[model samples]
Target: MRDVIEGFLTFQQEIYPNRLELFKKLAEAQSPKALFISCSDSRVVLEMLTQQGPGDLFVIRNAGNIVPPYGPEPGGVTATVEYAVAALHVTDIVVMGHSNCGAMKAIAAGQPLDNMPAVSHWLRYSDSAKAVNEAREYGSADEKLNALVHDNVYAQIANLKTHPTVALALDQGQLDLHGWVYDIEAGVIDALDGPSRTFVPLAENTKVSALSTKLG
Candidate 1:
C-alpha cells in the first residue's frame, strides 16, 4: 500500500509534469481507439502491457472479464460498451483474459463461494465458458485453468455481440472484435484467429488500433 502511494506521488510530481501539455489536451476530449475488457487483476496492467498512454484505450475491468449479454437491465459493462461504440465510435474491441485468473479458477474447481454471493451471481456470466470445460477432459488443474482462460475470452466476445450497439457496428463493418489470453509468467499473448478459430501468437494485435484512430 505504501509503495502504491509512493508510485502515485512519483507520477504526480514527475510523470504528470513531464506530460502536462498532453494532459491538457486530454482534458478537453478523449478519442480512444479500442474498448479493452479484462480481469481486474493486479498482474495485468493495461497501459503497461499495451504500451498505450493516457487515452488510447477505453477500458472495463471486472472480476472475470465477463460481459453479461445485453438484456432488459443495463449494467456498467453494458453502458461502457454502448458509449465506447456509439458515442466514442471506437473501431476495435478486445476482450482479454489472463493465465491463472482467479475467477476462472474458482469456476473450474467448482469452489464454493457461498459467502461471496455477489461473486457467485457474477460468475454466472461465465456459464458458456463452463460449458466448454464440460465437453473436454483435463488431467491437471493447470490444464483446466488454462482452458478456462482461453474459452472465457471467446465467451465474453460472444456476449459482446448481444449488445445492440456492438451488433450494429459489426454489421456495418465499423468495428472489429478480438479475443485474447495473456500468459502472465511467459509475457506472451495468444490472439484468437478468426479464420482458424484457434489461439495464435498475438504479435499483430495492435494493427487495428492505428487504423481505428484515423477512422475515428
Candidate 2:
C-alpha cells in the first residue's frame, strides 16, 4: 500500500509535469480509438508495451483476459465493453493474451478452486479454450500452453462479438476486432487475422499502423 502511494506521488510530482500539455488536452475530452483487453498480469503493461500515453487506449483487464458471452446478468466486463463501443466509439478492440498466464495455468491444470470460488466461476469463461486444448494433439506442456493462450484470445474475440454494440459496430464496418498473443519472454506480439484465421507477427500486419494512427 505504501509502495503504491509513493508510486502515485512520484507520478504526480514528476511524470505528470513532463506530460502536462498532453494531460491538459485530455482534461477536455478523449477520443481513444482502441479498446485494449488483457489479463491482470503484472508483466502485461498495455500502455508501456504500446508506447501509449494518457487518453490513448480504453483498457479492460481481468483474470485470464476473459470475455464472457453477453448475457442478461450484468458484469463489469460487459459494462466496460458497452461503454467503449456504444459511447466511446472505439474503432478497434484488441484482446491480448500473454505467455505464462496464471489464470490459464490454473484452468488447464484443473487446480482445485474450492477456496477460490469466484476465480473458479470467472474462469468458466474459458471453457472453450479448455475444450480446444483437450482436442489438440500437442506433445509438450509448453506447446499446450501456447495453443491455449492463442485459442483463448480467439475465443474471447468471438465472445466480444456477441455484444450487441460490438455486433452493430462491426456490421456497419465502423469497428475492427483483433486477437493478440504476447510472448513475454521474447517481447513479441502475434496478431490473429480474422480473414486468414491465423496468427501472424504484429509487424506483418499493416492494420497495426492504422490502429496506431487512429489511437493517436
Candidate 3:
C-alpha cells in the first residue's frame, strides 16, 4: 500500500507535470485509437508494452481477458465495447492473452474452483476455449498451456463479434479485431494471422484479414 501511494505521489508531482499540456487537452475529451483487452495481471503493464500515453488506448482488464457473448442483458464488458466502438469510435480492438496466465491455466487444468465460486462462474466465459484445446492433442504441459492461451484470445475475438456495435462497425469496414498472446519471458507477442490461422511474430502478422477474408 505504501508503494502504491509513493508511486502515485511520484506521478502526481514529477511525471504529471511533464505531460501537463497533454493531460489538460485530454481533460476535455478523448479519442482513443484502440480498445485493448487483456488479463488483469500485474505484470501486464499495457501502457509500457504499447508505449502509448494517456487517452491513447481505451482498456478493459479482466481475468482471462474474457468477453462473454453479448446477451439480452448487457454486462460491463459488453457495455464498454459498445461505448468504445459507437461513441469513442476506436478503430482497432485487441484481445491479448499471456503466457503463464493463471486463469487460463486453471481452466485448462480443470482445477477445482469450489472455494472460489465467483471465479469459476466468471471463467465459464472461456469454457469454449478449453473445449477447443481439449479437442486437440499436445505432447507436453507447456504445449497445452500455450495452445489454451492463444485459443482464449481467439474465443474473445469471436465474442466481440457478437456485440451489435462491434458487428456494425466491422460490417462497414470501420473496425478491425486482432488476437495476440504475449510471451512473458521472451518479451515477444505472437499475433494471430487470419490467412494462415496461426500465431506468428507480431511484425509478421502484418495484414488484418477482416470479414471479407474468408473462404467459400
Give the alpha carbon lDDT tens digit for every residue of 105-160 in model 1: 99999999999998999999999999988789999989988999988888888888
Q: Provide C-alpha RMSD values for all models, in order.
A: 3.5, 3.6, 2.2
lDDT by residue for model 2 (83-112), tens? 999999998889999999999888767789
Clashing pairs in 1: none
Q: Which parts of model 3 are misplaced by more than 4 Å?
A: 72-75, 208-216
| Best candidate (score: TM-score) | 3
Where's the lowest-lDDT run of ten residues in candidate 1?
207-216
Q: Please, what are the lDDT tens digits per residue for candidate 3 over residues 182-216?
A: 99999999988776777888866566542336322
What 10-residue stretch in candidate 2 is worst by lDDT? 207-216
True-structure lDDT of candidate 2: 0.86
Stretches off by above 4 angstroms in model 1 are: 204-216
Q: Compute the lDDT of residue 102 as modeled in candidate 2.
A: 90
**What is the lDDT of every predicted structure here?**
0.88, 0.86, 0.88
Residue pairs in steric clash, candidate 2?
none
Candidate with better lDDT, 2 vs 3: 3
In angstroms, the error of model 1 at 80 is: 0.4
> Which 10-residue window of candidate 3 scores lowest in summed lDDT?
207-216
